[model samples]
Target: MSKDLEIGKKIKTIRKEKRLSQSKVVEKLIQKDINMSRETLSKIENNNRSISAIELKAISEVLNMEIGDFFDEEEPEDLVTFFRKRNFSKESLKEISKFQDMVRILLNHEKIYKGE
Candidate 1:
């Protein structure tokens, strides 16, 4: 799939996961002075229209997600599903917990390195 479509799919998935309707998202965008119509948002979510940087930023804010989340090659939902579908042993669970901690530490270090 195209990158634009991928990003749009991510946006739609996250919006739905957050229990937000397109109209509700548009309402929030208006509160942010974006003036987006629900139709426009639908088009965006369907990959029928391109999104501007400002629109993307406002949408991310309304969705309570970072803009970078939309651009990630791996979907977070996939990882969640993988974990949910697995019946791990105690040792495996412990290893997963340690891996999660390491990932957190690495992310924190990356943020600090970037002066974020």
Candidate 2:
């Protein structure tokens, strides 16, 4: 399956697991004065459309989850190894640069993975 679809499924699963309906989520967003259409929210939850950072933050907050929680996915061991390798490159400066970027990205990834 496509990565976007996989991510969408995760979103749907989490929403269901939390017993939250699409309308309910929209209501929460409305309370925050965040105007979001039901269809737009459905597309996001289904991964039918790319979500924006602000929208993601809104959803996460409404769901009581971290922003990264939406992107969390169960990756294969090989992929994990590959990302781990990318975390640090050879050459000292290069390694530091790569690690710095990784720290920023993975900090969000890890928060979602941990469901915190």
Indicate the worst ten consecutive residues by lDDT in candidate 1: 75-84
- Please, what are the lDDT tens digits per residue for candidate 2 over residues 37-79? 8888789767788776677677778878886665655665443
TM-score of each: 0.62, 0.55
User: Which candidate leads the pack in TM-score?
Assistant: 1
Worst 10 residues of 2 by lDDT: 75-84
Q: What digit string (tens of lDDT, one per residue) describes model 1 on residues 1-116? A: 78788888899999999999999999999999999999999999999998999999999999999999888666454333456468766676667777777888999999999999
Candidate 1: give its CA RMSD in angstroms: 10.4
Q: What Cα-based lDDT does every candidate model obtain?
A: 0.88, 0.74
Error at 33, model 2, angstroms:
2.0
After superposition, candidate 2 runs with Cα above 4 Å error: 1-4, 73-116
